[model samples]
Target: MEHVRPLPTYLAQRYHGWKATTFAENRAWYKRLADEGQRPRAMVISCCDSRVNVTSIFGADQGEFFIHRNIANLVPPYEPDGNQHGTSAAVEFAVTSLKVAHLIILGHSSCGGVAGCYDMCSGHAPDLEEKSSFVGRWMDLLRPGFERLPAEADETTRRRALEHEAVNVSLENLMTFPFVRSAVENGSLSLHGLWTDIGEGQLYSLGISGEGFAAV
Candidate 1:
């Protein structure tokens, strides 16, 4: 912690510019949000990929959505073993406390985390195979999704398949939490699965039947 470095000059300059422009334009709105508190309607769980922009994609303003990002956007099954579960904690807060109307699992194409999971599960990543690898363990949540892919497809197709599966897997796991299931059963919450092609700027959403993703 003591070895932490200051922000890069370029990033600091960008921040200053944003503070003087975007932040300045929304000063009153920001102040109002600060005074009134946030009441976001949706909670988006997305990949921690730098290319994926949750707010920009939706054209959302601040305080509009509660966003949580993690590797591959995977969510583990409901576990109350008293361990530190960061993603689960966020989901718990969003569903039980914040009462978000929607919970969306957003996955994207060319996700390195998904790729890593692919490598790890395919017996190609020995480092990740080690028990001490945190990323390896976190990515294990997506293995079921990866395994469901047809063994005949090429690597690219399988990778994309796994990416979409990541979203579905998360949606299913989200329901395992009692609070999330209660919210959905009571009509207070809806679950969504989405995938994005970063380079093509194309977005696809899973159908109501959960068959496959369709262009949106």
Candidate 2:
């Protein structure tokens, strides 16, 4: 109890403001949501980057999207070893319990996680190579993407390519889950990958051929 603290002053002020305005204006909607439970239409897996606002980008309101954010938005291959798999559990719940019709992997430009992965794979980041680094181990999931990059590509090109690859890798790894595969095969679920350039506020969608991303 001693370790627990109240919300910061700024956060508390913002929360109170939201309660007075947004919440008050939509009190009935919020109450309905609380009583009926959430029935989000889609599930979005995105990066933990503070700049990427999934709700604002889509103009989504409460209960519209079930979002799961992680480093670089990476999804590891299906590993049901009965361990603590937070992302996997989220996917399972979203697909199996919620029966979301769409599952989206959202990647973005200038992702720190992807950059760290690139450095680690290139052997420039020795600290990430250590066994004790959780980030290092997690970013290992993106190594294959790093391997797929063109050998002659410049640093800037490689950086952007890796960001797209993060989305591609996640989309591919999502299929490794039996539940997800089953849902897709049954035509109940559809998978999509997207990348956004933070600087330009431009979005690109993975092609049907899964070869490249195109401006959307």
Candidate 3:
């Protein structure tokens, strides 16, 4: 790692411009949304990793994508817990309130959370009893992905296998919600699993056939 702190000259300059322009843009868009009561077209479940900015990736302006980001981009099975979950709340708002038509679960390569999934499957996960970080708990949703992989596979291959399979699990979990399932059955909503290769900017979407994923 570089021992020096990188100068934020470019970032500062960019933010200064954005602060002015973004305020102007939001003011107009807010009025439009209020007047027309516009609804978002899609809701995205994305990784909370700083590197993967979903809105920016989609070139979205303000309210284009209803977004929920959490570690590993996980979707827990529908449980009306007495407590509020950030992701769950966003899903509820997007589906029931905002009436988004599409829900996208985006998984990316080189994900630390996914690496944690690989670690969990390999039986080398960090102790959760210590309250290490949100990632520790959030990543637990992916534990099942590990169980789905072959036990005899080598570590490197196993992780790659788990990464792909984890996307499949995330797609399955999306339907566990009553509203999400109902909407799909009623033809009001569509769900998709997408794999993003940040290193190459390639997006692969799981096909309807359920056999192999195809490039988007």
Candidate 4:
């Protein structure tokens, strides 16, 4: 308890504002959600970027999405080594427990995690390449994307390409889970890949057929 700190004045003020505005207007809805338990139709896996606003982008009300955020919106290949796997646990809960109708991998432009992976793979960020770096270890999941990128592309293009590839990689990795694969094959669940341009407010959906990402 000694390490705990009080909320900053700005955040406290914003909480009060939200409580008075959004909470007050949705009081009944909130109470119903609390009483009935959540039955979210979709599970969204996205990056921890502050710029990515899943609720705002989808116009989703509270309790509509089971969302999980990590460094790069990545889903590692299924590993049953009996170790701690946060993403895998979330996926299992969403797929098997919640039985969500859709699972979405939301990637974005200018993602720091993807950029870090690019830099690390390009031999530009030595710190991230260190063995003890947790971030380095996590970003290793994106190495497949880095490998898939064009070798001679310019920095800007390569980074953006890798961002797209990150979504593709996550989608591929999602199928590695038997539960997820079974659900998809039986028409119980569908998978989607989305990429966002934060600055331009544009969104693209990756084709289910592996053709190309199309603006949506």
Clashing pairs in 3: none
The sequence of per-residue lDDT tens digits that candidate 3 reaches over residues 144-199 is: 88787877888777776666766787788878889888999999999988878888
Worst 10 residues of 4 by lDDT: 205-214
Segments of candidate 4 deviating more than 4 angstroms: none
Least accurate 10 contiguous residues by lDDT in model 1 = 138-147
Residue 147, model 2: lDDT of 94
Query: How would you order the candidates by TM-score, starting with the best?
Result: 2, 4, 1, 3
RMSD of 2: 0.8
TM-score of each: 0.97, 0.98, 0.83, 0.97
Mind giving the per-residue lDDT tens digits that candidate 2 earns over 156-178? 99988999999999999999999
TM-score of 1: 0.97
Winner by TM-score: 2
Question: What stretches of model 3 exceed 4 Å from their correct place?
Answer: 1-13, 21-27, 34-38, 128-133
Give the range of the ten consecutive residues with the poorest summed lDDT in model 3: 121-130
Local distance difference test, candidate 4: 0.95
- The sequence of per-residue lDDT tens digits that candidate 1 reaches over residues 1-216 is 999999999999999999999999989999999999999999999999999999999999899999999999989999999999999999999988899999999999999998999999999999998999999999999899988999999988998899999998999999899999999999999999999999999999999988799999
